[model samples]
Target: MSWRIGDYLDQSDLDVIVVGIDCNEGLKRLDEYGPWKSNEMSDVFSAERQSIGGEGKEYVEFIVHELKSMIDEMYRTLPGETSMAGSSMGGLISTYAACVHPHAFKRVASISSAYWFNQKEIEELIKESDLSNIERFYMDIGTKENTESMTILHT
Candidate 1:
């Protein structure tokens, strides 16, 4: 579980800081999927399939905490200006991070998010969490795919 920060830093000069969290389940799937799977930019099946069990939330929270600490120590960024974005399980985790720690990230962009993770646990979190401070949120998915899981997320 290493994070790539350069992808999100092409257009702007905001002193980008990328935080990577190691979800053991995700790593396990990646191992099974082979290193070549990492080359696919839009694949989320492996991560979504691994989003069951109790450790998911813990991993998300840990990432949020680490992100906060990184922002505080390295960039001096306030929560209102920071943006967090990811795809697939990373998207789900990014959404959870912003929702759970609203004061730490104000902008969230989730592409092909596994919103169905943990049987709507992410939805419940969004419904229950306080989000008065969040300023921006972006969610999108590929429309050509007809998979049921993607359908649910599209809706």
Candidate 2:
């Protein structure tokens, strides 16, 4: 997934360290396993649960523990200053990370999230999760996107 975070850095003088990780690796196909999916999904679009490899949780742990440790060794970083953002399936996983790892992902932007993969589960997760740690949360849907998914998101 491509994010325009660089645009923000260019437009503003805010110092940012944007680390991009490749979620599509390990010889697995994109449909087979991806960081964006945290649960099994059997929809008409595809029959694979991208979370079969546990990329979502694994990625969160990697970012919060391993990657953060490495970054801290080099630079002084504040607690709860990390942010995550993505689009489509990537957006889904970003949202998951923010909810599941609030202490790490303080800011989140999920654009056109594919919540339909497990709409009920994600909605329940959002409802059950404590978002007090989040300093900012942003979500958006285009007018030309899936109507049914948009309706569900609205609900």
Candidate 3:
């Protein structure tokens, strides 16, 4: 999507820096050779299975603090200027990050998020969060996708 959005950004006069994170690094091949071989999806990204290995919290913390700090050191950034975007489970983590650190991530785009993975927890978190710091939040779901657990933000 980033590769295909240049024209749209130019037309909208949106100057932006896009950073792509490879969240699934080495997990695909790790399973073929070691005792650590396991289901990377559930281990790393699934909030519902967090007790086992849901490393999403660590991932989000790194993005919100470390990564943002590095970028801020290298460039000039204003308050509420950072944004996060992702699809599927990535979207889920992005949404989580926004809720957890709204001041750090002022804009979020969650496309087809896997809300069903931990619907109850996320819904509760959303209800408890203060999102006044967020500037823009874009959420979408495909017509063909299951809507059973899609987040229904009341604000």
TM-score winner among the candidates?
2
Model 3, which residues run further than 4 Å from truth? 1-12, 25-53, 146-155
lDDT of 3: 0.67
Model 1, residue 135: what's the lDDT?
A: 89
Per-residue lDDT of 105-143 in model 2, one digit per residue for the tens? 889989888767556767888899999999999999988
In each prediction, how many residue pairs overlap at the backbone (N, C-alpha, C within less than 3 A)? 0, 0, 0
lDDT, candidate 1, 129-148, per-residue tens: 99888888998999764476
Candidate 1 Cα outliers beyond 4 Å, as residue runs: 1-15, 20-51, 76-80, 146-155
Candidate numbers, best TM-score first, in rank order: 2, 3, 1
Considering only N, C-alpha and C atoms within 3 Å, which residue pairs clash in candidate 3? none
Cα lDDT tens digits for candidate 3, 44-135: 43464332325567678777779888888887666468899887766777788888899898899989876655566678888999999999
Residue range with the least summed lDDT across 10 consecutive positions in model 3? 29-38
Cα-based lDDT for every prediction:
0.61, 0.69, 0.67
How much does each candidate deviate from the true structure in C-alpha RMSD? 8.0, 5.1, 8.1
